[model samples]
Target chain A: MFDEHENGYFTEETSAEVVAARNAKAEDERLRDCVNILVKHIHAAIKEMEPSQEEWFKTIMFLTETGHTCDDWRQEFILLSDIMGVSMLVDAINNRKPSGASESTVLGPFHVAEAPELPMGSNICLDGKGEPMLVRGRILDTDGTPVADAKIDVWQANDEGFYDVQQKGIQPDFNLRGVFRTGPDGTYSFRAVKPKFYPIPDDGPVGKLLRSLGRHPYRPAHFHYILEADGFESLTTHIFDPDDPYINSDAVFGVKESLMAKFDLIEDRAAQQEAGFDEAFYLVEHDFVLAKG
Target chain B: MFDEHENGYFTEETSAEVVAARNAKAEDERLRDCVNILVKHIHAAIKEMEPSQEEWFKTIMFLTETGHTCDDWRQEFILLSDIMGVSMLVDAINNRKPSGASESTVLGPFHVAEAPELPMGSNICLDGKGEPMLVRGRILDTDGTPVADAKIDVWQANDEGFYDVQQKGIQPDFNLRGVFRTGPDGTYSFRAVKPKFYPIPDDGPVGKLLRSLGRHPYRPAHFHYILEADGFESLTTHIFDPDDPYINSDAVFGVKESLMAKFDLIEDRAAQQEAGFDEAFYLVEHDFVLAKG
Candidate 1:
């Protein structure tokens, strides 16, 4: 006895279409489009999976728990996005640089501004807790022209696989993290420990999902970089150590082939003397190429 | 310098495929498939929407807020599903019945297990705050055979569109909610107020989403029912008032054509006497045909 209507009722077969039609009245075109696409995909997913009522309830609870697991100090939803690779995909879609420019990746949560900006060749390894490495790099334009006076902010985890903030009193402040200014020659060098593979924050709903999916939570060892210069598009990326164990399957999918750097070991007398090292150390020399703004 | 692998890296073009390949190791086949489908759709949505980082961040925060809004008292995720029409789809898929059998609908969040059983013809409208109505129906098998001693649990919002639980002490306990059993001839009749359209609990993220999408949160006037009988599947359903304003656009998408029933106003002296009403009352005759378990 229902009256004939334009969009009709929400039958399973016409559900998504009906919703899209109903949402035609939405004022925000972008939001309406986004909502329609999301609704279409989710409906397809449910139709394909045909999850039980209990399974649906479990998903609802999982989302609720994921949200509950987040607080002022932690964000479980971002973790969920990372594990699902949406974070990287979003970065990729948003940061499609010129072919030769350094690729952007996840900035991560550990980065802090106002890092101590040191002169060329200064050591950033305040604690000296891991393999001593010299990170030297030049900031260049996409066409390979060196850019003078570029600011390169850098940070990484220490040997124990923790940021200074995570370890607090256990690690020195700004350990394995600092900023460097490129000289007129567009070259900068700094000393820090070789980065080590580390597990992301686990023991949350995202962690539980990772375990359930037969996935590991470790991100490949890498140094975080945020580069900025005049009239150029700033870049946020990581120079991943190619040899790190989790390099192939980064939990957050943050790795790119062009971003991979060789951490070469050097023990020559001259090199050791220049590095001010008494022992052989890893040397990571990676350059960044920025796109025009 | 990265090693060659089966699925390659997580590039935007192959992001979903790479994740599906990586998850091939998942032990639970069903969960793995579900995860793959969900990831595929989400990636597609992101690609289509290409939400800016700020928009994505807003989404993450919205989800976190939705979760945080949930405690022992409320579930905002379920509200999100309802507004998205996912809840009704899930119920429809899970409760597919035999041909000619009554279709099922959302049970909603207000159902209580221990609703006091009342005799047929007894009034369930404890508050008597709405238009009086006599509900008569036969519980029958699919072949039109009467099903004796069938349990019919019923509940509805009052004229003010609030469930008893929602009003607490303001409305008498068990207002317009009760259980009844079919007699030997499978005939059952009861008196209750005609349900009024109501907005779902909306002071949360789901409500914000509805307002954003230019949709209202009101469900059409309807009475909820859960019917049970021997050798047949228990049915959860609703009888929609065909003339309800929101019938075509139920926020939860809970209505179906076959579930619509006519609510005729009967002012005849004899019918009013029979309904035990001194004023005009609505009369609804709807039978439930159940499917074998």
Candidate 2:
């Protein structure tokens, strides 16, 4: 039988335990654990800060605004999580890879499911305006064997640093998005324009917070990819251009050395002919290895 | 100078530190400190939880829903804070009281400034619904000296446990809310119905969270008050009915032993006549002590 007189009441000293004790034993294990973890840490933070009433209310308002700013077309909370390095942390925790597999990173927010499916060696730069580049990569298993029929979905910002979705009418639908399935040789290739660094939406509450923190909102220019094969784990990752100025300071802390790829200048005529480009072009070649599920 | 090769990239081991370092040298000191506190604790929580990607995104969605639930008429976030014990924690931190001074608690979210200012001993219950109660008190300084002309704004739910605003059409406007000032003798009196224990709105994401945690949303029967006097600190607090079943376990953890008041049945005709009531009624008396600013 429970003690009738014993109750957890509000006090500065027992605040966390009181809050966390609300979780009943009948609750889902996952939720109980998560909420308890959150309660303990949030209370700890509040205790450490001892924020004034005004400051506490300001935080309440910030959370309100961050939540209010989310809608069907935009998710400001995820943006908040991303900028705070939470999305990356969660990604890292969930997608921990084996020693030789490609390291996974953030999937970002611009991916669209209906990106045009195309054949290998097709050009995704429909409105080509920047330096022509050939992106080639093979799908391999960790054991050095080719993984055939692997699907690679890729998307990137335009040369002007805008995604097709961000520009809407300005950029044609699916302008810089494509999907390809590798063949028996496990090789996949496509043509694209060099992506430009772009700023995240800085007009919302998250943006205001970023400004207040003296942090810039631009992410380093990179190509996004989601790779999948029949018996292997699907990978959500990005391929960072090493020469980009913002490589070291991604707004979301998503950059990793293993995910960095070299962009080489190809000048040989045979190389140009093989890639079906008339002149010298940039070649970004990086192979990806996947672990079986 | 910054090194070109070094970056605080996303890594599970260094996530919190990386996020905290993003607060640049030029940012506001207070904001930087608060954000760093938040970043560190949030990362610690995530690290402990190791929440799956779906679970993390569900949290993002929950936040968005909580935010979307707020509007000009309601503030779901504050309610969320209340049920989580955060609002009370923040209030306690900001209102640390001296010995012999009245303890402070949550202001709650239902207070309206439009409550009518009334004479002492006026009945706040426009509708004769529940047991009539005679409530009286004196406002005094920490030294027990009467503090004349002190303002005591009081409000509470009706016998049916509904605030005027919550039952707008059913209850008269300002039915149980009033503002009163003490006399030269520091005595203040009011007539009202004994408030019933009531549950907070259980229809939002916060409610879902509460239900999932096996917690009830009911707050004990209590009268809310805000006291202010010249040369003294303003106090936001509550006086709880000791007989109420939920008195010890408030949903928001707002209850403190010092804030409890005893209600006695007054059956003497002379006393009832003195209270201007034709029949026997309940009498609850509690004095407040405020600290000098």
Native-referenced TM-scores of chain A, all candidate models: 0.95, 0.95
In Å, residue B276's CA in model 2 sits off its true spot by: 1.0
- In the range B107-155, model 1's lDDT, one tens digit per residue, is 9998989999998999998876878999998999989999999999999
Task: Provide the RMSD of all predictions against the true structure, rounded to 1 decimal.
Answer: 2.4, 2.3
Task: Name every residue pair that clashes in candidate 1.
Answer: none
Instruction: List model 2 lDDT by residue over A53-166, tens digit each.
Output: 888888889999998889898899999999999999999999989999999998888999999899998999988678889999899999989899999999999899988998
Scored by lDDT, model 1 comes in at 0.89
Which candidate has the highest lDDT of all?
A: 1
The docking category that best describes candidate 2 is medium
Global lDDT scores for all candidate models: 0.89, 0.88
Residue B283 of model 1: what lDDT? 94
Instruction: Name the runs in model 2 displaced over 4 angstroms.
Output: A1-5, B1-7
How does residue B72 of candidate 1 score in lDDT?
Answer: 87
Please provide, for model 1 over A86-108, each residue's C-alpha lDDT reduced to its tens digit, 9 standing for 90 to 100: 99999999999988888999989
